[model samples]
Target: MKSSRQLSKIVNIFLHIIALVFTYFLLQGGSLIIESLPNRHTQTQLEDYLDKAQLDALDKSLDASNLEAETLSFNQQSVKTELKGLKDVLAIQQQNYKEMLASRYVTEDNQSNRQVEQIRQKIEQGRVAITEVTQKSNQLKQQLLQNQQTRNQIQQEIQDLKGEARKVLRQEQRSNTLKAFLIRLLFVLPLMAIAVFLFKRFRDSSYWPFVYGWGYFSLYAFFIELVPYFPSYGGYVRSIVGIVACFLVGRFLIHKLQDYLEKKREMEQRDEESRRSSLQNNERNLENSFEKIHKGICPSCDRKFVSPDNKYCVYCGLCIKRECQTCNTLQVSFNQFCFECGEPHREVQENEHSEEHAAEPNDGINSSPPTPSGV
Candidate 1:
């Protein structure tokens, strides 16, 4: 029966261990899935797309500006040089026409007249070329300004799109965090509740070992799998729990130690009082102790002898040796079995044996006598 009870305890412990391991993995696996995908793929991609768009817009703005700058720079270099050269040629041609006009007046010949007319036509053509060059330069500069304005507008649109993307990304992140927390909580809450119930109700029962096992699994699951994924301050929560546990355990141990000490002190005082009383009965107690070492049962009081005898226990008395009924060999009176005969014997209590001995006299007076004695 005892072995069966022990076996059941073992089975209970084993099952508890199995359950704890199963719960650990179940929670850990679920948490792993949640933690691995804390953010949604679509939301992440959208945010990235927005960021890229902003950069692309800025790049396009820069490219367009660079092209316009190069065009303007080239126009400035070519137009200024061409306009200067044209102005110089026009001045020289005008001077040549004036000289031709003055020389024609002095000569008054058909050849001089034709030269003057040709010079005047060349001067007019040069003036027209300068006017056309200045107008073309102005047109190119105006086109550069328009491109600059267009680039600024495109850049502003890019900024607006990027801001929208940031806003959406923040919202998505918040939603995902909530979902993950709920997922972890869903698995943790029920297991934790069951563990607490078992600890409280079955902790001292035949299934007590299971309580410890469940407790260990519950703690590991909460700290390792559940708390880390809590909304915030995971570390603080773990630290506070540990501190409280340690404090409670320390306090319990201290209380137990104090109680034990108090109980021990009270027992010691009682023992001291008993020792003093026995000392007052010293002479009688000494004689009982001496006889108990040899007799095996108390002769002074006919009570059971105390053991470890060099005449010491408080129950020391005249130790009587009882004879084995089967072998007629004396043996220890307090023992229920004979050593030599290997026979079982009844153990008689001191008070009951005394009562039986007192009844023997009454039985003697009530007995019938022999016939000769009666005559």
Candidate 2:
């Protein structure tokens, strides 16, 4: 009989686990459907909302200005290079004229004088050429400076256009995010409602495994899928939601505890026969009572045992042990069959046990209680 009870418990656990596995698969399928229902937004698609025409025009203008500045800079460099070469040539010509003037041979003095005058005229012309080249270099430098200023202005305009475009893109992204959140909320709310109904209506029914499985799935969906999408608003919204959930759950638990106490008080007021009959008919309640008895507590009153070997509960007067009629062996009162002789035991009524307890002090005993109806 003990082995049979153990087997039933194992089977019950296996069925509950199977129910949860199937429920997980259902949640996966539902999540896929919900995700497909929304018109999802992509980063690139939102960017398309910004008007980029002005930005593009500014970019082109910046590029053209950079190119013009580079050309002007190159021209300035070439003019400076030419000016350096002209100055080198003028220096060589002036050095040759000085060497000739320092020569003192009289016969070639007159010829040397005429050569020196020609050299002086050539040096003056070279000086005029250097001045012209220097002026050209200066003009190139001015043009390059103007080009640099224009490029700077273009760059500044491009920066302003880009900043405006970024603002528009951000607005579009926020709007799309809100839409996605609403779509998901619509899908999950109905599921949560149905789950709540099943929990309240059928949680204790025979098909409780499936009911509990759906309840677990709904809780996961609400906390994982739906709650996280709520607009955080610096965590204020989530905080408020958490507080409300705590209050509702606390209220429910308090009410349930009060109801349990009320029911227990009502049960204690009944006669011993009715109380025993109610416990015997309920397999779950009977099983729980047997478990508590094993722990040395009164099954009916839930009080700790003051002594280890008491035949009846001192606090509640509930029978805890008895002697089998067939084998005359002492055993638990709740057991239906005698462990020693394999003989089925008869039900010992509360009145009979009470009489036996008063008549016999220690060695006397009675038959065991009846089996639970379900068992």
For residues 1-375, write the lDDT of model 2, one tens digit per residue.
Answer: 111377777977886897798689878987788667544444444347545787678778878888888887788888888889888988998998888877725456687888888889989998999999899988888887887788888788866666676778776666766676788788788888988999889887878788888888888878877776776666887899899999999999999999987876787676554565566666676787778788988777678888868877676566677677777787776775789997765544444555777765533222223222222
**CA deviation > 4 Å runs, candidate 2:** 1-14, 21-25, 39-46, 94-108, 114-129, 246-281, 293-330, 341-375
Model 1 bad stretches (over 4 Å) = 1-43, 47-120, 196-225, 232-375
Candidate 1 residue lDDT tens string, 55-121: 7768777787878778887987799899999999999998888888888788888888877778788
Backbone clashes in model 2, listed as residue pairs: none
Alpha-carbon shift of residue 336 in model 1 (angstroms): 23
Q: Whole-model lDDT for model 2 versus the true structure?
A: 0.73
Q: What TM-score would you give candidate 2 relative to the actual structure?
A: 0.71
